[model samples]
Target: MICPFCGAAMEKGCIKGQHEMAWLPDDKRDALFTDAHLQEGAVLLASSSIFKGSVVDAWCCRVCEKLVVEY
Candidate 1:
């Protein structure tokens, strides 16, 4: 993929996490949890089980130091 910001060649990769991974709107708070529970309206990217974690396909632009992901 080509980076939309800089027209640079993007690299294919996967985003991984041990526990949970998600994308939230910029207006939302950084806290993903409230009183030990998950907040609403989070776009879950990957979730983990007892044995393994899930991965989401993504493209990274090293030139712009940006990452693009689809859930």
Candidate 2:
């Protein structure tokens, strides 16, 4: 996708790490990802839930040095 802010090309990528959705605040969790894009079969609903690693699709705008995520 193209960056709306700078008209730069966006590269596809993923963010993989120890992301505990349950540990994150409800508002933050909700805001971090779009409900439509979240994969099926939820494994995280609270702070105690854990995953091997969290991978979220994202786009990088090197020109702006910023990341845009679908979440």
**Model 2: which ten-residue window has the lowest total lDDT?**
40-49
CA deviation > 4 Å runs, candidate 1: 26-38
Measured against the true structure, the TM-scores of the candidates, in listed sequence, are 0.76, 0.54
Each candidate's clash count: 0, 6
- Per-prediction CA RMSD (Å): 2.8, 8.0
Model 1: per-residue lDDT, tens digit, 31-64? 6444212556667787766687768889999999
Inter-residue clash pairs, candidate 2: 22-46, 22-47, 23-47, 32-71, 33-71, 34-71
TM-score of 2: 0.54
Query: For candidate 2, lDDT tens digit of each residue in 1-71?
Result: 99988999999996665543423344444544544225344444322226555666679999988887665
Winning candidate number (lDDT)? 1
**Error of model 2, residue 54, in angstroms:** 0.6
